[model samples]
Target: MAKSTTQNIRQIITKRFNGFFVIMLGAFGLLLFFLFKVVFVDGPTLKADASSKYLKERSIEAVRGNIYASDGSLLATSLPKYRLGMDFSVFKTSKMRDVFQKNMRPLAEHLSAFYKDRTADEYYYKLKSGFEQRKPYVLINMRLLDFQERKTVLTFPVFKLHPKNPIKTGVVFDKVNVRYAPFGQTAYRTVGYMKDKVRVGLEGAFDKELAGVPGHGIFEKMDKNMWRPLDGNKEILPQRGLDLHTTLDVDIQDIVELALMKSLDAYKGNYATAIVMETATGEIKAISNLMKNEKSPTGYSEFVNYAIEVSENDPGSVFKLPAMMAMLEESHMPLTATVTTGGKYTVYNKTMTDSHDYGTLTAQGVIEHSSNIGTIKLMQRVFGSKPSKWYDYLRNFHMLDPLDFQIKPVTGKPNFNVPAKWDALTYMWTSVGYSSNTSPLHLLSFYNAIANNGYWVQPIIVKNATKGNEVVIDYTQTQKRDSKPICSKETLDKIRIMLKGVVESGTGNNLKGTPYGIAGKTGTAQRRVNGNYIKGTYYVSFIGYFPVNNPKYTMLVAMDKPLGSSEGTYARQVTAPVFKDISDHIYARDMKIQRKLSGYLPDSLNNASLHHLIHPLDHSILYANLGFPRIEEDGRWLSFQLNKKEVKNYGLSFAPKKVANVVGMNLRDALFVLENQGLKVRAQGLGFVQSQSIPAGFPIQKNALITIQLH
Candidate 1:
């Protein structure tokens, strides 16, 4: 009787549980149906409504900081740029339609003339189409305009303010900040950029300091789907980012860039890197890593920071300097120590030889001539029995350590293994700038230490910064030495002498006549491709300090795979000349360098240097600002010689119905001329156009494709 009662009670409980589950399932299904309706059926309408009128917390973008050169010239900065839009919906009204129709043609003509991007008929069609379709917001042009352009654009007929109904203007714009370098692409990599929320170069390195704290504000949606802060003022004011004061010298940077471009143009190399640093402080005055870009309007572009990226390069004979230091420090070899170098030596059945049979040479003679045979002979003579000791000396010079550079994480560190890993092949090859992968920056540091009295200072880019008051930051702490001594004073002096001898008499004699006395070494290493050395390809470099006695600056010029014969690809022939040109510019600009020269440099630039191919407007602006008389000239571009008094202009003429010659014109002027003719252009390279696919004076065609190459 008790079991029967229990079964009845369990049956009742099960029925209740089943009923509850059914009810929950129905309720969940209903809830899901409602969710589906909201998400799929009415999602767009709801989202539009939410974005159109909702009062919500919105972020106010903080103004990013500016980057200034050491001399306070603006290098990189954010400026307000606006994309123009037209509220064509206003033209739907009968009274507004009359005004728009009457003024639209004139407005289109004015815009066509002002922007030169489209024909008057096209603009009229765009405006007419947007109005007929009742577009709430119609983009006037895809191009962004500066503040001055914004003000100027309002003067157009349909865009100008109405006497009472200001809304009749039908003009609108969205504001955004654009990152620009005032000096064009100069120091582009160093100043850096942001794209798709990813930052690079100094911009990436100092993003936290440069990107200020953002603040929140209550915002309400306005007509045309735009949001406005609830109040005229922000609820929380955003702090502007701190400005960075960099060690870059704009003039020096220009000099370096131009010199490297010239070298790249002359050598037809795949790429090149040039760096100039302050000797004592290790401040980077100018750095350039230009690479070949067949697609660029200029044949070259700065896409990689080759200066610090990888030590993929073998130091070649440049490694001899460190070897010289090692031997001087530990081996105590005299400059007069002799070695028999018949140009070939073998270690572990692997042979090493020089370009020339350097017969027999003293220690100094070996370095001066860059004799590979002599170098190997001397190293063997000193540490041959225990070649492992050779590795110890290189390690002491910090050759084996990572640069840990500020700009980029260095890779392919000088491949120095522990003594246990030393072998005949490794020792022989490593002895002559092979086996170890070393970067231009790391290799430069070694030379910098010698110039800096043996104190190895880390190379730095930023000088200081400021936060609010002046809107700047003080990053201005002194750079501490990375190491106390690269070598003893005696060793430093001996190495310095040997390096000077390299410039004076060695393979680097291509730069022998430099008045300031360049103390550097030249290196030429056969480029290894696919793990094998190529027959004719090469990587060459020249690095050293100038004015040997004073040691004001240290520089490195490196190039890879320069074209032409093997004879023309040597470092002295291809790289050292560029070093000389840059140094000459520095010597001319710096008062201290001039003082050191005792009036050796000319007071003014010669006419050869002054001759320029530039847009006339550029010179006009420059002359106007400098209080010099402007030349009476009008053309797409101009060639001129700047003298103290009169301005000279090599005249230019263009036919309205022909493709304008843009070979000597800059990218800006070139685009202005070509695009105005309704041509579709694909431009590559940088600077003045070198060639145009469509010959000048070819009959202009609307929507014809044209390509221009620059260098």
Candidate 2:
């Protein structure tokens, strides 16, 4: 019975074991079927799910536009920047291995030269490791590169991309917009700034045109909350902002800032401002406002747009210009009319005085000498009965009218007392730039009108706004025309003469002896502080235009009570020099003003050669302007010859360090060339350079002195 039970138990155990094996095989078969399904059917869908997810749409910022000066110099710009990277994906194919290997040394060498951050050997090792390991992505340079720089690097050896070639350099660059101001702190305030959504200057004025519109795009959310741009690119590309071409001449602006800073530094002035306007168009070429501050790194900073500030001090003698104009317009009074001006005159128990007493003076003399008493005397003579006649002329001249400047800086209209609130002494005081005030810019515009043949138009800072070649805002079109000038030509002629006399013989006598003519006024006004005029502290200013005969530009320079300056010489000491300096620069730059006086000589070859001086001047235009008969003269140095006896010298260009052929050059022109080549000059005699100690075409030597004998 035990044997029979054992046999049955064994048979049952074997059958159960076979059954368990069959069950295991079925489970394995089921697993294999699901694995086959996943590998073929579900693969694409699962991978797509892993690669993407719907997230909130993102706003892509448009490229901000560039702000350029009048000369096409970049002031503010937002450019796309890039970072260099490499991919060794090409290494996956053995067919391109030789081509890639051959480029390794040259590519490494080029990288070393371009970056200058690593040696050729170091770069070679890095390149080899990246290539051998077949790095999918390797950052070659983390440094941000400008558009031009990345473009240049693309042409280098292995990095170069070919239009026809199937293979790529395995190089890549990431891009982002970077805003830059090439000229730092030069026109810092005027070029503008934006902080906390509060903008200032041009930035604030044209934010819509400069900041650009933003674009919306749907992007895939990746690991670490990063965004991945979707293919089929559901992105709405942003439109680039319009480019602004401002009226500012950065070259002139730099000079103005330097000139003003120099004067302010020397005088220890608290604050100073200067503005240059195109005489005809009222376009501001340059404007600078600097305030004294110890906290600043440069001991000065620009914050307040004081050039256009409304609440400023009295303009002193400068205001006498409009006062005189009013007198001329109202009664048809001649500027030559005699007005007796004593040492002192008491009007309504208030005393008005002059620096020095003149027994009797013409109406023109009042403005020329900047005579406070004479001006008041003219006002008393002309408008004594109804001083409101003087008041009425203010409206006619647009004195109280606040300007709609392109810079958008004015807070209020001019600070002038109304006629209804006038006292007895108001007319007497107002006759000589007292009790009324305006911005330096307003004052500049007023002076600019006189320079612009009495045409009063608003000043604008932006020339135009452009998108590519198309104009978005033609500011020139916005300028309106007037049927009449500020005054009659006869009055303007007299005003011009009076202004010339000021520099030639009157209060502005110190500003005499300039090569070019200057027609303007010198004003020294008492600074009204806490409702009282400060004795030592005064606002000294100079407002004028250069080449008085034909004005091209007008400028105003004002200083708020320079520390070491006294009342009498404040304007002369501080502002006149700046005016003269800028005037000289402007005059020298004008091709129309290039005239040279030659010494008389016999019509011989020796002297005739003297007329053929080499200097960079277009003589064809010069001679044409002079109405000289065009003579047939051959050579690169274009010379204008009246005859063999009277010939004018000029030239084109000179290479550096090469001894210039200045045989026919004047002593001034000869010295100019030699000294510029780092050569010391010893010039002799009068007139043009006849002969030189050293021959032309020789290499220059350091501290070398070149002597020239002039005939």
Off by over 4 Å in 1: 1-56, 86-142, 162-170, 219-234, 294-297, 385-389, 410-415, 468-473, 476-478, 595-711
lDDT of 2 by residue, 544-576 (tens): 998788888899988887887365447877898
**lDDT (Cα atoms) of all candidates against the true structure:** 0.78, 0.77
Q: What TM-score fits each model?
A: 0.74, 0.66
| Clash pairs (backbone) in predicted model 2 | none
Query: Could you report the Cα RMSD, in angstroms, for every candidate shown?
Result: 10.6, 9.3
How would you encode candidate 1's per-residue C-alpha lDDT over 115-162 as one tens digit per residue? 898999999999899878887667777688877678778777977746
lDDT, candidate 2, at 659: 86
Give the C-alpha lDDT of model 2: 0.77
Worst 10 residues of 2 by lDDT: 609-618
TM-score leader: 1
